[model samples]
Target: MDSDRESNSSSSSTSSSSSTSSSSSSLSSSSSSYKMIKAKVFIWVDSELKDIYKIDEKLTWVEQKENIVTKLLPPLYKIVNKKYSITNRKLLKMLYGRWRSRHRTSNIKNQGDERVKQNKRRSSKNSRMQEKKKRRAHATNYLIENKNKYILRYPEEDLVKILKDSGYHSEEWEETDPEEEWPITQSAVVEDDEIIEEAIKQKSSSIYIHNKWWRSPALLRLLHDRIDPTVELLKKKPLTLKRKRAQSSQSRYNTSNVPPIGVPSWCLNQDALEQFNYSNVNIPVYDYNTDDQDNSDNDIEDENNNEEEIQNRTNSS
Candidate 1:
């Protein structure tokens, strides 16, 4: 009975210890699984972050430096490979050394794959650029061969349509005159006196008025009256108008010849006829003498003009 009782106790102790060990194992496994899931979630989040941008499909040097140190060495190898023209046993050894050091690095297992992916992407880009250059060269050669026939000068809309019919992709060209593009109204073309005054008032630049007195006849006469005394004092010399002495016979025969308008007259501006001075003030005595000579010359010119007209008419007939 004693032996059986001891055996039962031992068996019970063994069963309890076994049950405790199983429970502890289960708890440890569960904790490991939780830790693995958390680590995976952190990695996924870090990978997707925009600030964690990649270079050459893998993380950039900045990103890898922050998260994965082991990937940094092979990229250095690539840089050295690009920079130095000498590709020899030394460079090969250095690359091998980096590649082998990868296995010894404990923390970053993904570094090797990142470097490989970067190299592959870089290779693809180089190949694509080479292909593009080849295509461009071929296209340029084709264009050069047919430049005279294929090239269009100042191409119009119809040329674009023709190109499109011949399977070319063409964009629309815009042609517009710069002057006609301004938004000028018809009223602005025929501006009124008020508008003209406003424009002159707003004008910032100086205008040279050639004979501004000609625009206002009243002002011109007022100026002439003001400056008359100054003119009389200028007696250094006087330029006389050339005149022909009237033949005594012709003078008597031509009583019907009225004086032409604006003849010289000192008698016209008399104060007794002040109102008539403005209307009938003859040209200045000196100016009238000059003008009379010009008129007689003009009459001679008119006779010559009539002769030319008669000759032209006869030629035409």
Candidate 2:
């Protein structure tokens, strides 16, 4: 009986210990399930770190504060705003407010938002690059049209002749057959890229403003305030002015000041002055230049195209 009692007590103690361990494990697992691992973002901005709470243009004030709390580090998020001067504060507001994604893109955001932001930035960059390329191409065409106007570093046709002559014997260097296209090499690709970059920087050097400023470099001062952010700068045109009908200079000059026959001078001077300033007049003034007007019948049916594309997805699917 004494031996049985001792054996029973030992079994009971072991079972109790196991039960306690299982309960402790269950509590730990429940606590762990409630906890979540959050993702973090890291950025390396201009070598010197800035000290301020960040403001976002796209996001509201509440969202900005939330982003500051969740995205920024503890030290950065905790920084308080100081009592700035009235003028300085207003200027700062304008500076921060001038957030145009079309020209310049911001990088501050969460991981997912950053991806979308980067895509927009890339598109903007590509558009700007295309515009620059187009401008350079136009400049090059102008130079070609008036060869004597712009002085070339290499005026001789030696390079062109050599390239033309070499084209006949391209098969010698190419790995493929003469009938097939030659494979693109790394050097050829790099050279093409370098040529494009060099062409854009060759012209449109600040002609007027750069020389006008005597002592102070006024370029930085000019950039101090945003230049009408809501409205975009008009597309720059060529330097040449286009002349209309009445080829003679005297007739061209007098077209504006002289009132038409049948219209009185007093009437022309009164209401027409302000109205004609914006390409409008009380009486019809024939514009000889604009002959071809827009015909809306030529517009593409984008919705129909989209519907057709969706319906025709069977082959791919």
Most accurate candidate by lDDT: 1
The residue pairs found clashing in candidate 1 are none
Judged by whole-model lDDT over C-alpha atoms, candidate 2 comes out at 0.31
Query: Can you give the TM-score per candidate against the true fold?
Result: 0.16, 0.18
Provide the lDDT at 49 for model 2. 22
The regions of model 1 sitting more than 4 angstroms off are 1-12, 18-22, 42-47, 50-317
Going through the candidates in order, what is the number of backbone clashes in each?
Answer: 0, 0
Summarize candidate 2's per-residue lDDT along 1-317 as a digit string, tens digits: 64464345445544543455577569768655322110011121111123334445565545465544444434432221122222333333333334334123333444467687656554643453354334433332222323311112121232122222311110101011222222333222236446533211111111111111111111111111111110112224443322122223322222123323333222233344454452334532111112324412221242234335535663467
Best candidate (score: TM-score): 2
Task: Give residue 170's lDDT in candidate 2 (0 to 100).
Answer: 9
Segments in model 2 whose C-alpha atoms lie over 4 Å from true places: 1-49, 52-89, 98-118, 121-286, 289-317
Count clashing pairs, candidate 2. Answer: 0
Compute the lDDT of residue 291 as modeled in candidate 2: 31
